[model samples]
Target: MIAQLARKIRYIADPAFDTRDGYGGKLVIALRDGTFIERTEPYHWGSPELPISAHDIYDKFEANTAASHLVGNVGKIISMIAALEDVGRVGDIVELCRREQD
Candidate 1:
């Protein structure tokens, strides 16, 4: 299965793309049907031009942290992070992130 899937996929790097600061340029997808699809994004998503919303951040956090070390503490983490200005001790948040005993 791995070999068959590897044969269907190929990654070709383009030296012309300005990928110095994690910027994504043109992406071309050539399917087996002799058709190609292209997408170009010169700037990163969280950059000035393509700013992300707080909701987007929350969603992404939830997605990435699924079944993580802080499984049941995600809501508390989000709440504390949202009101970070009033959080006097950063260790409180750090404590929540720590995995409990087995």
Candidate 2:
């Protein structure tokens, strides 16, 4: 999988890359035939142009929490976050993120 990803990926660095325009950084991919493809503005998930689905957010939350070895019911944490608007206190979320004692 790593090899396949490496083969399809390209990276370019520009010393003048800037995001002061609020459009994020630019990405340019130069082709072998001398032409290139470019994106002047970056797409941010959950933004007006590019919106992320709830499932995707939950997937990311699960992946990050698992990788961090956080001790709690991940499903419950996700539920709490999803319903954060109705939550009376923010400390409830903090309690769920506490490390479990061994």
Name the candidate that leads on lDDT. 1
What's model 2's overall lDDT? 0.74
Q: Tens digit of lDDT per residue, candidate 2, span 1-102?
A: 999957977766654544442335576777889998987655456666778899998998888877665635798888888899988888988877887679
What overall lDDT goes with each candidate model?
A: 0.84, 0.74
- Stretches > 4 Å off in candidate 1: 1-7, 20-22
Report the C-alpha displacement of residue 54, candidate 2, in angstroms: 2.8
Model 1 agreement with the true structure over 1-102: per-residue lDDT tens digits: 999977887677777666775576777788789999999887788987789998899888888889698768888898999999999899999999888887
Overlapping backbone residue pairs in candidate 2 total 0
Q: What TM-score do all the candidates reach, one by one?
A: 0.81, 0.56
